[model samples]
Target: MAAQGLSGFYGSVFRRSITVQVLIRTRDHRVLLLRNGNAWELPGGVVKGGEDPRSAARRVARATLDPGSDVGRVLVLDYVQGSQRQGQAQGQGQGDSIAFLFDGGVLSTSVSAFTGAGGEREARFVPLMDWSGGTDEGHGRRWGAAVEALELGTVVELVNGEPASAGPVPAPLPRRMMPPLEGFSGILGH
Candidate 1:
């Protein structure tokens, strides 16, 4: 089985991967997204060994969005089974993954205050209401579901004094291949 292979390879290893989802709200109530070469996805990546999910989220946000900026609270923990590898059956892979979703607000300061690599790409801040109308040409269905959930107002909630709505329960979505190892350079920062 897949578990057997993973354990054998990593010496009793378990599937415990971490991914992050950043929801950046712009001044106009739009959400920021990155075109990951071909597909449009929230700026995120897998967490390294022994790294906290929150730190991983921040690292991803910095790499894809604004570095040196603080990330807000974690909004949700979307769990999914499997690894980024292909040919593995459902529920089979190296580890389990918890997709940590965070909500970020535009800084009242200035863009210059937050800078990092990949900043020149110009991240897209799309209106939430109009997201559903857009085509998911390169993103495929999984990304489509994430986008739909956000547009439906089912992914996040306002954190006031009272408890927030659970929003929409995430449905089962197919796992996509993880980015290559080189793409994760500096993700762990040694």
Candidate 2:
């Protein structure tokens, strides 16, 4: 009993986090890119507990990019194994990551006029072919897959550059189909 307790208490705890990211295009065939410094990442963040990833994509956009934009179907899903910051202090935690890449479609307004509301320093629309930085930061494949998804209007399940799942993704349920909230019965059109 004591041995089991020691093992359980001393073993590393597994942590996992889900993130929702979106790719938004422009009418002129450009993609909206946000820059913080030398590297610019696609828009996304960690999904909150109990919050669905689909809606989380929209919420992330509203918090950063256009506030009223609609998030379309998921473009791609990727799973990255757990990682730790090299040379960090001991006892720091490492966690697995699951990410959903959603198609945010085109921006309703011009991409240039708007500055990023989040920590992003600036926002600009760049042509797909000339997106110089897209190939770096292990983002080339993700960007490619996302653009392909946008073009095909379908979802792809990718596990480390390989398609792991086949077939199209089902459309999201309408508001009526979703279950009503607790304590709000009868008022929500039961």
Candidate 3:
């Protein structure tokens, strides 16, 4: 029936997972990394159904890091295809996942009393230069891209941890030329 077909289509659309990641840094350029099993990851988790991503990000940050932490604009949007685990006999249909990287703002170096949430262990700050060496490769690349986007005040889109497009870099804008007021003078009565 038509209703059955429509329900199936809706179910498929809703199966995609949505995850949120927060990029919190220190003033010394060190990034926060939480130990998840053998891999280091950002402080974030799956976004609940019908939850706003920004709110989810804030919630994750509050749960994982300081409760008073602030969440900023999105830095990266990544679409990743789910892959089967090696040596797993069963094919668990892990559908595609969409991830959002949000700015968790900078933290002070003196603040180190961190208690992780979920499956995470201790949390530490690692220098930006050594992120890839200590964390999951995919997450490392995402961190790098997110950092660049944050610094440039832009948002980047990625597919499978890589830039979706290699578009040309935009040129800097020229200064606006405003005409002088006909009657108004300087505040100093010039």
Candidate 4:
């Protein structure tokens, strides 16, 4: 009876969706990441309405790197949840979001293009080994919970069951700069 009820519940309101994060690795072995205030994270955006997750991932990859580029197949489905933040007032009553993680290898052109940008604000890659050495309490708790739920093995997992990665790594980049898509809001609006 419980299984049947769950099936019905899911059937009535559950909507399938996807989000993608591209982990671009540079020629120097640095992993491309974004810093928003204080959190370090992969570059990605929510999958748009009516769009496939793979297509959305590809689109995000291009937007973060270049207008014309291709993103490869998924490396991992990190997490799926109703809300990333619960204590925050803004996170109240949101629906769901799924974060997809991918392995990105540098395209020769992208490397030169990023390098040419020439500014501290411009995109650059960080060595994964080095990234693993940093710590940020809040960022770790937030991103860590989602990562744990997704079951993806990330540096965040190194900590002793912490909700997010704790290290000196920079903050995650702002979401406003990310592409507009269905689940970008972090909270699902019914």
Query: Which stretches in model 3 have alpha-carbon errors above 4 Å?
Result: 1-11, 83-91, 111-120, 133-135, 168-190
Worst 10 residues of 4 by lDDT: 155-164
Assess candidate 3 and give its TM-score to the true structure. Answer: 0.73
Q: Judged by lDDT, which candidate is best?
A: 3
The TM-score values for the models, in the order shown, are: 0.55, 0.68, 0.73, 0.52
The lDDT values for all models are 0.56, 0.71, 0.79, 0.54
Candidate 4 residue lDDT tens string, 55-137? 87778777676777677545544443444433535334544555565555564433422432244434556664565522544
Q: How many collisions per candidate?
A: 2, 0, 0, 25
TM-score of candidate 1 relative to the true fold: 0.55
Q: What is the lDDT of candidate 2?
A: 0.71
lDDT of 3 at 41: 83
RMSD to true structure for each model, in Å: 16.9, 9.7, 8.7, 17.7
**Tens-place lDDT digits, model 3, residues 79-155:** 87755222334434555688999999987786544655554468888787777834456666688889889878899
Top-scoring candidate (TM-score): 3
Score candidate 4 by TM-score against the native. 0.52
> Model 3: which residue pairs collide?
none
The superposed Cα distance between candidate 3 and the true structure at residue 81, in angstroms, equals: 2.6
